[model samples]
Target: MRWLLLIWLILWGTGVEVRAQAMSRPKNLILMIADGCGPASITMARDYARAVLGRKELALDAIQVGAVRTGSVSSRVTDSAASATAYACGVKTYNGAIAVDTAGRPLATLLEAAKARGMATGLVVTSRITHATPAAFVAHVPRRAMESEIAVQMLDQRVDVLLGGGWAYFLPAAEGGRRADHRNLLREAEKAGYQVVRTAADFRNGVRRPVLGLFGPDHLPYEIDRNPQAVPSLAEMTRTAIALLKEDPEGFFLMVEGSRIDHAGHANDAAAHVLEVLAYDEAVAVALDFARRDGQTLVVSVADHEAGGLSLGRNVDGRGIYDWRPEVLARVQASHERLIPALRQSDRPDSLLRAWLGLDSLRAEEQALVRQATVKPDRWPVVLTELIGRRAVVGWTTNGHTAVDVNLYAFGPGAERLVGSFENDELGRLLAELMGFDLSSLTTTLRQQQPVGESR
Candidate 1:
């Protein structure tokens, strides 16, 4: 009987059932990245949703597959550029590298490979379209800060859908833009057959195959400070991108990034961070919904790295009395980005700071810190962030990235393969394999090509 069972197991492994499933590979891939989000970030956002939004849980929290260790070749603590490069190119490179190996050699990104296979590719981000995370997937540059070159490369790649900020980099410096060269990329994109949309209404109304939407001069505004008339929400962009990319018969690969979560974390603003996570989860919901209905789509949600080392706990006084002031989080009406600029422009910085932060409920020492922040121009952002964090019972270790594992949530076809923890670059390999591409062969091909900087 044991011998018969062994024979049955072997047959099942190579049977028609396994072969049929393997032949029906996923037709669409959606990678959702919440920049600077870690497990602690998710926990805080989950609790905040439970208390404030009155929702049972976020869409992302419901699909917890596992975690991934995020580290670059250069350091244990990874920056957004390096971590993004790992997933985009399936190689561990230096912290500042963008889609390039440690020696500044270019690597073929998943997007490039997908496009090469006749798949539609789309990038939807809350950051500038040429920002590090989005740029890594399409542009090969030695430094992530080369926005001008990145923008040129992105258009040259002919990405099917492009949405987000950083219109400044595409415009010429003569027109109040940042680019030193006088190349009008907006016009270039139009010549390349892309329908450029600058307003939310245009984004929602425009129906085009290759679309370009640039809503802000720099990065888009935080959710709390966003003007809906000017900037579209992350969820809106995800929906629009899906609608456009799903038309391709060859399938599609779309990357949606909640980029400002990293910015809020860098500021150590718990209120903004929680809101950004919630906003990102909304985009995740959109992808999950599509994947559920399509069945041939795989939706993977992950974070590049953890920033701020955020912790949520009860506040302690000098007398060692523990107090839980969850209601203090309710008083935050604006984000640090919104409040800081207002404070800087205000005639009475102290009054504006107190009102913006709701510091009436804060302790005397915290209130004193707020006053100091108002007076000291150089240290104002840090001190103000600390005051708000203290009031909300949020603690932060540093205003930088941390060497911590981040959560990975997935749904639909091919998600089970990502259920275990692994190195950051390994995730890229798994993704490429799922898409029926060998990342090793792609990297080998890139390495054999003329060195990136040399003329052919």
Candidate 2:
């Protein structure tokens, strides 16, 4: 009986492989990343939508495929740079490496391959365009902190569509930005034919082939705090990128990231985390919808790592109660990060807290915590989230990322190829394979053109 079971399992695995090989190649690929989104985050969002929003399902629930193991060469828990590089360059590198190997050698990324093949390429994210995840796709650097250098390389690549924040990296210190070299990359970008748009209106109005849309000086506002008229949502960015890139006869490769979900997690803010994940789900829907209509498009949604070690249920106020009150989160109108300024200025803080947080009167200790966090700007997010999370019965184990595997969801052609467990780099190689390109050859060519051990 044991031998029979083993035989059946082997046959099933073989069948999956055969089907994957038999499937037609996808013409377009959209990789949607929810940074630091763990399994609990999805469940928390699903439950909130069901109980409060009255929705039946989330966009990601239907396409549930498998999971991916995220780890770097240096640590069991991977940072965004190393994990993203795993998906970009098909290599397991030390943390802080952006599309580079352990020896600090450059490796070609999927986006580079697509661009080399004359297909359109794009990167859209809620975080700065020069951040680790997006930077891994377009830039190579020894350290993830080299945003100014990453920005230069990104422009040199000439991606078809670029949308996100971090304009500060492109400007000089004289222009109130972080760049010390005094080089204005934005001006250089314009010279290279990128229509730079800062406002939402400009993004909507612009129809150019190559565009650079920097919506904020740093990371964009969290979803709950975002002003729709001022900044575009992740879904809006994904939709617009697809519209622009799909015009290519060959195809396109676009990466859309819900970057702030990770931030919310690090702060242990259950309400903010829920809102961010919801926004990401909307973006996933946008990609899935496009793939369904086009038939030749592949949509893949994944997470680099799980942050905050969030647990859905916990004892409230140190009581033995095991119940979780997701309704507590539903009443939150704004994120703790957004409420800091108003909180610092408000004369009647208790009154403001009750209104904004949808809470009754707060305990003296909770009020004291809020007041302390208001004065200390760096502590505001975690302090506020603690107060809200206590009420919601959600608990966080750590402020940093966890080593647990994250879920993978997919739709469209060759998705079945990824319907099982994968090491992060294996997933990257599989994506390159599905695209019918050789990343190794591209890496060789790129290495020959550039000197080894090059920094910045």
Report lDDT per candidate.
0.86, 0.91
- Please, what are the lDDT tens digits per residue for candidate 1 over residues 378-438? 6777877667656666778888999999999988778878898979999998888888876
Residue 225 of model 1 has an lDDT of 77
TM-score of 1: 0.93
Candidate 1 — which residues are off by over 4 angstroms?
Answer: 1-12, 17-24, 314-326, 359-363, 447-450, 454-456
What digit string (tens of lDDT, one per residue) describes model 2 on residues 236-294?
99899999999999999999999999999987878889999999999999999889999
Model 2: pairs clashing at backbone N, Cα or C within 3 Å: none
Count of backbone collisions in candidate 1: 0
Model 2 scores a C-alpha lDDT of 0.91
Q: Per-residue lDDT for 424 in model 2?
A: 95
